[model samples]
Target chain A: MAEVKKMATRDAYGQALAELGEEHENLVVFEADLAAATKTGVFRKKFPERHFECGIAEGNMMAVAAGASTMGLVPFASSFAMFAAGRAFEQVRNSIGYPHMNVKIGATHGGISVGEDGASHQCCEDFALMRSIPGMVVLCPSDAVEARAAVRAAYEYVGPVYLRFGRLAIPVFHDEGMSFEIGKGETLAEGDDVAIIATGLMVYEALQAAEQLKAGGINARVINMCTIKPLDTELVLKAARECGKIVTAEEHSIIGGLGEAVCAAVAESGIPCKVKRVGVNDEFGHSGPAVPLLKQFGLSAENIAEKAKVLVK
Target chain B: MTYEENMDLQRKAVKVRMGIIEGTHAAKAGHPGGSLSAADMLTYLYFKELNVDPKDPKNPDRDRFVLSKGHTAPGLYAALALRGFFSWEDLKTLRQIGSHLQGHPNMNLTPGVDMSTGSLGQGVSAAAGMALAAKHMGNECRVYTLLGDGEIEEGQVWEAFMLAANYKLDNFVAIIDKNGLQIDGPTAEVMDSGDIAAKLRAFGFEVEEINGHDFDAIEAAFNKAKETKGKPFGIVMHTVKGLGVSYMENSVDWHGKAPNDAEYETAMNELNAKLAKLEAM
Candidate 1:
């Protein structure tokens, strides 16, 4: 058995940023006074001169990142998702997205797993808000390894990118050398009864659900759909055609996260399938322990298996 | 600065004003009052202060200019066209469909523009960022942004000021066109951002105040900005809402309204007469 590691996606983000900073000298980072929490402190330690402490101003930080891009610098602006996506959406839209600047917004503490911070800090609508901006690439990596790879991919791609990360330490499920491509999904398992599509931390639960389903004599396929915008439509349609039942699990709003994206893709492809969405349903999160919140919000492995069973029936 | 140099800048300012009038008149929907007020400063920067080439507009080392108060695109477009970044004929297409001259400054669409800015108080933030980038790269390229006095009412402007000062961005200059009038009324009535110079100074900028329309004062302020180091510079230029045209001068109604046929002709005639006088000098 492989020795699994436990790490927060933000930790992976910081590590990848430090590595990218070494490889690309033109890479710069901007933060809004949450460096230690957001884990940009790691990169700040390595490259103090390249890190800009924007001092609690996300709007200014966003526009500043846009400005740096004009000077040929790939700037990664980091902050909590609530501030980055909610408070500074206009700046991100007009300054970076409209001009199609080469700026990567590394937003951490996304979704309800930011436990104990309550509704003000949790950002479940970021995927939806960012997806609406034209020329913006929205990525939500499922694990530590994938988060690190997503950072590198965003750096290579020349345009506006929003990379969402979480605060809680999730399991590092995948191997280090697994392939990662923007706008592409990776099928982690194959089955015939149903397909379980997931993004961000929910991929782990979806895999667990697949495992539990196997014991019940119902096989389920698990897939990691990282890129929400520019989604991998061909793979999603294939899953719909093959399995005929799709269940999407995410730590975001059911309105516009992986579920809506998968549903839209399936509907646009003229394929009919039974779709089940498992996430925060048009509601805000309350202060609670991370594990309990997952169960309370129906985002746990057990709940996912139950949903799969109902769909399989 | 030499008298000849000042006179040359004066002539260029007149041409820029003419272009602004022509641009707004042709569009039939643009802000001429603020554009005319900002003509001299834009003219001085484009003609003398900025180290930019029309041939290589995207040269990384060139000094960057951001029109933070972007509704005044006519002023920026005129300066760019006169500086040979584009054809002067295209200046008439301001706000027209398919024209590179958008209602606001778009860096992608316009050749000489360094940052895309339309929403108030945002361009200064971007300009400060550019200055920070230049400082990090150990480059000497400077960044300059023009902001409206009324636009200072936005809280984001103060955030940008704080960021600029905190970063110790010496390679940055912010010019405030204190036109005293917004679309609604006098800025004092709308939202009194009391004492613009003092507010910026409190924010840690090495501040200067000058008459925006005076060529000599404009030259001195920019030169002083260049000499000062270790802090960002702010030049609060006292300016009328509309400088060149008689009817539009200090008029709130003219803030964003384009001239009708009769008024357009009168504004053009006035600007041309000023141009003739400067050309004769």
Candidate 2:
């Protein structure tokens, strides 16, 4: 493989927001004191008039975004995943979700990738919390290119959406030719032995897992399931039919994350395929380096390959 | 602004209180005490303060009102209906299975509701957001929000107040219905807010204390709010828990209970007598 440029998904989010500010006149950005970290500072620097610094109040920011949405403004509210999804869930649910406001929640530093922040800052359950809200679109982009596209797509689509971004610099595997669509899954490769369905940074790991599986004479398919809410059930069912075994990967918890979503879809289809979930198993993450945490929580490419081997067997 | 106008507003407030009784009585479950206490304020806002239209309830440039104390949906619904946003008949259907007038104000379901708010302390932030958006658009639109005395116990309320002040939301006004009573007991006993005016002033608001039920004071406070500049406005209005009904006033039991048939009739009669006396005057 050639040397791929690496960038944080949040960096892409910031660049995309700056670009969006030039396009959409009504596009407003809000931050809760973490604009520099969440990368909304890029938008703030260019469009200070449209950028609102809401201070260190996530609950207030969520409701403020919802209020702005009522007036036909596309408000992108950004904060760490812990504060945006966990601390201010009720505000997001009641203010934005219930009213179906056109506010996009840019939740940065999602999952265990928020390294050295300890368990308190590392939010691995945001996927579960956001997915529980009715009429909330949940999108987790795989790489920087997809993350940038996801930001534009969320602004174009009118409604409440939670776009999760990560802090660690990951490989930019996706090309600009791949069009981003909400609620649609992309099949990266085709195989027959086992299917690896993934989201966020885990999609790259799933692709790597496919390469590893190929060395062991196992043909593993790679599918990037970006939209978690209106999940691509068609691709999931097709994979279950073609490949008799399935493995799901994410940087989140096994409960209520992509793993459970895939399992539920397979079970609903009554497809008798053995499903394995590769994620943080019903536990909290600790303070560590991002790569080591991925390895510790069985979220790495090798770990995904190991899970795929069992499912294939 | 005048004696005759105040009397007219007083009569409208009486009608608003009667609507509150009618709605809660029909629903058989609601927070009547808060609703009754907030009736006069809602009447003043809808009839006099807000720059809105019944024909175009979703007007973008019009001033916005958010019921931060949203359990008082009856009070808000009554005011909206009387303002010709809907029929009085719709207010009676509050909390019913298919009623648009939900137990809490839903902005999508209810016309003229700028923001749907039920969870305490969340609506103020929403109001601040509306005010911010108006400022961003360079429109002269204003935003008003009403909060309960006891509902200030939520930490989010102070957070919202701080933001409104920090952003210098001069177009925003927050009115705290300081009825001094909650569901458990008196607000001072339940959870003493400790000099709400001082606290709000510290939070950078132009604070005013007034009698919430008195039309003159309510009018003065709103007028001052509109004229104020460089800071958010706060009006801590002193009011009775249940303002009109003789038996329910200052009583905690009426905080979240519907009046029985006899109680409802008695309350309506008292309001009717007051209305008749005002008209004769």
Candidate 3:
């Protein structure tokens, strides 16, 4: 057994932007004074002329990005998820979403994984807020490779995109050749006993849970749903029909995140499957180390395996 | 700058004001006060300043204008219509269910609208982005934005001003219509934006004070903005809310209220008389 590589998705985001800057000359980056934190400083260092430091004004940054998008330039505005999605929701909705601007919002430090910063800094509600925007394409990549690929895909897409990244370094399980589509979900493992649907940081946890479930003689299917908005109904419905039972996991609230999205898809299609949600159960996350905090919030492979067992039984 | 030119602009402005009344009267809802106050400048930008073509609205080299106080869509729509961006007859359908002339300026729907801006303080940032993009691409195109005195209260406006100044967007011009009144009441009574010119200067802009409705002042200020270097330009235009309509002038009640049929008739008659006088000049 070899040691698995680990990298934070934010790191991938920065590297992706810098790489994309070379390929796309019209690609511009805007940072709300979180260039180093959000990793946009990488792109800024490479192309100082194309980078815009928008200070700490998240709302202004969003609007400025929207404006740049109108002028045939694809601008990626970077900030903490709390500030980008929570604080500047209206600006995103009206300025970016309503007009369907070609602006990518690179929101890092998402979810309870923003360790030691406490509840205020942790944006557990970003998925919900961004998902509500009519034309916004919400994405939460599971690992470094996926995150990098998602950035390229978002760039190729011709509308507003909200990409959430984590502060904690997670397992980079996917290979470089793995396919990453905007509105499609990838089935990580095949099974028949129960389906474990997951997104963002939880996808790795779900895969681990699937392995644990396999050891316990339970064949669990793992689906990595990176694109939250325009949820892959085809895949969700297929999982629902094949497995007959499901457990959804994410580092976001169960109310409006992956859990609810899955529920809606299954319920609307009249699929006869038992669905259980595994996530932060409508509570704020407190200050702690990232991994430990994730475990405490029942966002670990152990918790996911436990939840999947219930659905399987 | 000639008398005939000024009179021509005045005639166009009078028509723009008439469009505002006509549109608001038909919609039975809109911010006519700010729209009327910004009519002359809107006319000036469309008719004289902006190098935009109606046939080619999306030309990359054309100057861009954003109505930051987008509630004054009537003024912008009128200007766009008169400039042949669209038919003026569509003005009557302003704010209607299916009309492209929305309650707020929607850039996607309206041909000449450079940015969709209704939410206060957001449009100026968009304008700044446009200016920055033009600079980045080495394009000669300039960006202009119109904001209300009341709209400036939003903290995002200052943030945008800071960015514009920090970037040294000399091609950007932010025009604040110092229309005394807002939806609540007079701007001084509600939130005194004390010494807007000084505030703009402090924000590192090359500041200019002008009479908004004065064609000569408007022309001179825009020229000075073009000549200025190393920083963004801010024009603090002293304007009367509801400038053209006699009953609506400086009236707080007209801030967001559409004129009734009789009020509309009176407003149109007054503007028509002004147009007649300008024509006779």
Candidate 4:
């Protein structure tokens, strides 16, 4: 097997922003003193004039981005997910979301992948919080290519967007030429018995789980759900109709993240599908190494494969 | 400013105050005290200061006014209505279902409103963002925001002030309506913002203090603000809560309530008398 390249989605976000800056003159970046960590510093290095350092004030940065959006500028306000979506949730809701402003929030280090930051820094509730806001587009990219594509898609789409990126360097699975669209789910593998729907860092894990399930004589369908809000109900319903037994995976809380969204879609369609959610089981994550913590929290391909195996049996 | 100019602004301010009373009374539940206190400055900005066209409200080069103290939407709505952004008759429908005049300033619904603000201490940051945008785009447009004295205690307001100063947004102006009273009681008792002008100066602003109702003083402060360079401008307008109405003045009870029919009648009578006096002058 060829050695897979590994890259953090936050790095892809920064590189995508710098490339977008060259294409869109009105593309400006705002960071709440996390330019280096959130990877907006890459864009700052390239387009110093368009970059705004808003100190450690995420609320003010969100409002500033909202204001800049009103003046025909596409402002990407970057910060850690804990601060961007958790601390400044009201600012994001009232200042940007309420007005339906064209502000893209680049929230990095989402979920327990933020190693050693402890429960305080790991933001597993960003998708739920951002999803609650009306007219907010919530996106979580699976790999580096998808992250870059999601950033460009956010810039092209009008209104507010919340793009969650992970801190850990994960496998870059998707090809650079792959098409990415907001509200569209990409199916990586075909199956008949069970379907594994996943988002963010867990998409790669779902693919690995699919291979494991294949060896165990259970053909598992793998779907990468990037857009959590305005969820691809069509694809979700189709998966439910075709594969009655479904397992949803994410590096987030199972309560209101991709799993709940998929469950809601399936339930609303009145489809009789048994769904299992493989995610952080409604608990805060303590300080630990990223891979070990993820495995311990049951956010691994083994867990997903186990869940799928149960449903298949 | 000339006596005639001051009288003209006074007349406009009285009309705006009447509009505030009308809107709040019609809603039966709205913040009238802050709206009345902010009426004079709202009038001055709409009538004399802002380089905005009522016919072309969305013009990119136009000066932007954000009611950072957005609970005083009645004052802003009245000023915008009188300036021909909408019908003054529509002011009666303030906060009603299907009304464009929301309880707070919503930029999308109201024509002259530049930013949506209701939650305290957030609007100033938006104004700062607008100022930064203007500086970046080289649009040569000024951004103005109004803040309540009590609103500054939110901590986010100071963050915005820091941003405005750090960016050297000379084209930005932050006006605080120091009405001395919030919903609780006097601002001194309810988290006093001690010496706002001095604080603004410390935050890298060219500070000016003035009687908010005094048109000449308001004019002079704005002129000074335009003249000052390399820093943002802050105007601490000392104002009385419910300035035009007789009974509501200095009363914290009137902070967020509508007047009864009899009290409304008395308020309208006093304002009408002031209008009659201004018209005669």
Top candidate by lDDT: 3
Distance (Å) between predicted and true CA of A184, model 1?
Answer: 0.7
Candidate 4: where are CA atoms >4 Å away?
none
TM-score of each: 0.98, 0.99, 0.99, 0.99
Q: Provide DockQ values for all models, in the order shown.
A: 0.86, 0.89, 0.88, 0.89
lDDT of 4: 0.94
Model 3 interface DockQ = 0.88
Candidate 1 backbone collisions, by pair = none
Q: In model 4, what is chain B's TM-score?
A: 0.99
Clashes of each: 0, 0, 0, 0
**What is the Cα-based TM-score of model 4?**
0.99
The prediction achieving the highest DockQ against the true structure is 2
Q: Write the per-residue lDDT of candidate 1 for residues B170-216, one digit (tens) a residue.
A: 89999999999998899999998889999999999999999998988
TM-score of chain A of each: 0.98, 0.99, 0.99, 0.99
Over the stretch B226-266, how does candidate 3's per-residue lDDT look in tens digits?
99999999999999999989999999999899999899889
For model 4, residues B1-281, the per-residue Cα lDDT tens digits are 77888888989999999999899989897899999999999999999999999999999999998888989898898899999999999999999999998989888898988999999999999999999999999999999999999999999999999999999999999999999999889999999789999999999999999999888888899999899899999999999998899888988999999988898899999999999999999
| Residue lDDT tens for model 1, A1-313 | 7867889999999999999999999999999999999999999999998999999889999999899888889999999999999899999999999999999999999999998989999999999999999989999999999999999999999999999999999999889977899999999999979999999999999999999999999999999999988889999999999999999999999997889989998988888798999989999999998878888999888988999999999
For model 2 chain B, give the 10-residue run with minimal summed lDDT: B182-191
> Model 2 chain A: which ten-residue window has the lowest total lDDT?
A304-313
Give the interface-residue alpha carbon RMSD of model 2.
0.7
Q: Is candidate 3 or candidate 4 better by DockQ?
A: 4
